[model samples]
Target: MDFRFGDEDETFRAQARAWLADRLADDPAPDPRAWERALGRAGWIGLGWPGTDGRGYGNRCATLAQQVVWAEEYARCAAPARLGHIGENLLAPTLIAYGTEEQRRRFLPPVARGEELWCQGYSEPDAGSDLAGVRTAAVADGTGGYAVTGQKIWTSLARDADWCFVLARTEPGSTRHRGLSFLLVAMDQPGRIEVRPIRQMTGTSEFNEVFLDGARAAEVVGGEGNGWAVAMGLLALERGVSTLAQQIGFAAELEKVVSAAVASGAVGDPVVRAGLVRQWAELTTMRRHALRTLGATGDPGAPSVAKLLWGGWHRRLGELAVQVAGAAGAVGPGPWSPERPYELDEAQRLFLFSRADTIYGGSDEIQRNIIAERVLGLPREPG
Candidate 1:
């Protein structure tokens, strides 16, 4: 468990840090798309994707540790939140793994260049955690593609996305995980797709409900009726080096919580002080576990374990944040008018947003079930 970065990795880190510093130096409020394009042009977007060109860093082929270094440096620099993460981190890898050559050529470039954006269409109103229970239907449209019809809730960044990778029941009588197909649907087709923002407690709509009525899939990845495997594979990718970068961001948030506690004198309270200490220690342990599991193969339990640890830890951190804020946490934005009304502060937004940390990706209960059934070989829960 050597945590130190090798010499090459350190060199990569220094390069990444310098590039980010130079890019972020000029524009204090750079447009997200512009920033993403800058990163993409600089060949910093897809570190793990194959195929090297003059436009990409893919030529060098970064190792997992190198990817981790870039991720850490990116977070440490507080660069603009990635606008192409769904495309680069999640969908691109899945595409490389399961997509055809044509599909790869068509989709991978935009993602690598940060020119196109993607949103996942997996969770539905009735099938949030139970992905096997997805009811979105994608029937053959007489042509080669399928006509998708259903609603997807909790779709992150759906409003601004150019495309959506959806899990739909391609078979008429399909139930549970069976008969599912992974369909890539265009989001701009007028009258076929709709996106409604889901306003959160934080007064922002980072998530949305997307409705597809006779929407057309551009193509199906991993073949028709084999979506369950593809979807599961994508989920596994969700637990990759990005998790290390995410932990870096979490460390930032935890620092804010501690700083808030100190500024508000909550650190004087023994219980609050102890909670901060425990949180710091747990975050360190989580990072070690994440690093250790980087090269693990064929372990069904790793992703679930990672999810369970981070989800609960984040939820607890949120509670601690609000607790440290004390009475001030109870107050939210004031009424708005023409000019300015109300806005949530950093701590308030953290408390509100982190409320969904345990529920969104996969519920705590679901993660437990996965760990039990797959990892420990325990009996499956009776439906």
Candidate 2:
């Protein structure tokens, strides 16, 4: 594979880098919703959408390489983490692939405009890693829509989202992957949907527990009983273009860790220095692998491999962050109380969040099983 960025890609990269530098130099708003709209208006939102969506929805259909360039530049400039990414990268693409023309027309424009935010309702209290085990049910409401009821756990952006793409059982007596559906639900149904934030040990509520008591699913994508495929496809996207952006963020974290090591004089230890060098080398490898597999949709193993690579790498980096910080990284800034808890510093937050890097999205064990059984054609593990 050619590693070089073509002239056009370089041009796009320059534009992306310049725009990010200018916009990210100062905080425009504390809220990321405003930032999402700004990106939408600039035609920077859906960088990899298919061309000529032509209705002038304002989505820029850049090439795969350009997409990578934009993601890298976006992270390099330390731009605020995108809140619309779930909509633009996952839901929008899934809709384009499997949704009706009306659904696309209704949905894509708002996402491109960043007028809405979306959260995923895939994992349930009982279903998580075993995605097919979802117990959430969606029954026809006798109108054009269906009423969704059940619970979704670890739902990112649930409180702040304007919509949620839910995976639910549509048919009675359905089990596992059968009779499932990909549902598009608006989050504004008052008195029906409830979002209770799950506070993390890091003193943040980035995840939530969502209760849907007859919440309405206004649209269904990929038809009824085909949700497994759609959900897997979305997961594949999660492992694709977004992985590159994640790596860029990982790179930034690594840089900060190194800087912290230097400032703390931990670089004097040969072991610490060696660990840092190993991390740099592994990150470089991951970047190249992501580039090579960026467009390799036929390679079923790529996504799992990418997940495993970054998951373990990030967990180790968290350990190194604490190690390099010596004893100081473990302490909090102030006394803790129910009304006022301790604040986590950058390294502490990194360490705490990274602890789940191997668990969420897909666990490390699950990824290995996927690679082994699906990619290597090995016998399935014993139950």
Candidate 3:
């Protein structure tokens, strides 16, 4: 497949770059929410949604190449991380695909305008990679709605999310993958939902443990008892053009590792130098593979392959970072006051955070199983 961007795509890329530059020119340090709103106002948020919905920026009209160009440009500009990424990238696409007209009208606008944020509630304490093993219960109320009651762990951005799209077993005796429903639950409701932040080794709370105690969800996407399919579809969307953008970020991190090695005299070590060279080559090859697979249909093994590639690559890069830093990486930032304990420098933070790259989202073992069973026609693993 040709990877060249056509004239129109190039023009769109120029326009996107200029807009981002102008938006960031003055503040140099604008608030993330404000930047997101600017993107929303500039009609850059819902690139793949339909224009008639008034939420999309006519991005659906653009070719896949244009989308890739925009994503690469966004990462290249070093803009603020998007606060609405979950809504725009994962939930919105899922809704557009399986949601009813009412559901679309209700949820897509706030997301398109960057006024709302969403978190996923698919993983449980026992159900990380085995998503079909979700046991969060969502029983039907006497009314048309359902009352959700369960706990979800490793929920990213739960503390800041305005809503959560949850996968819960809706039927009483439901087994794995059956009788499940995707329910949209509001996070701001009083007394029903609770979010406890999970402080990572990096000393940040991006992930959380969320508890739902009779929380209400009147909006169920893709009908009841069909959440497994909808959830799988959303997982597939997770490996879109965003992966290319992520590779750009990986390139930046790799550069930092190289720079640290050079500054700390680690580059003079032949083994360290060889490892850095190998990392650079692998990153380049990963980017090429991503570009090659950009517009392919949803192959069952594709997302798993992409996840396995980047997860392991990033974890290794983190290790290389510490090796480059040598003894300095062993120390914490400053003397570690009581008020600010566990503070870490850039290399330290990368080393700690990237350790989870292979575990979160999906594990390496799970990805291998997906490739074997789905792509290679191997027998399913005995449960």
* TM-scores for all predictions: 0.95, 0.95, 0.96
lDDT of 3 by residue, 169-208 (tens): 9999989989999999999989999999998778788889
Q: Write the per-residue lDDT of candidate 2 for residues 1-383, one digit (tens) a residue.
A: 56668999999998998887777767644478888898989999887676344544458778888988888788776678789989988898898778888888888889998898999999998898889999999999988789999999999888889999999999989998899999999999999999999988987889999999999999889998899999998888787777888888898899999999999899999999999999999999999998887778667789999989999999999999989999888788777888776877788888889999998999989999999999999999996
lDDT of 1 by residue, 283-383 (tens): 99999999988868788889999998898898899889989999988776566665544677787787778888888889989999999999899999999
Mark the regions of model 1 whose C-alpha exceeds 4 Å error after superposition: 1-3, 51-60, 333-342
In candidate 3, stretches whose alpha carbon ends up further than 4 angstroms from where it belongs are 51-61
Write down the lDDT of every candidate, Cα atoms only: 0.88, 0.88, 0.87
RMSD of 2: 1.7
Which residue pairs in model 3 clash with each other? none
Error of 2 at 274 (Å): 1.7
- Worst 10-residue lDDT window, candidate 2: 49-58
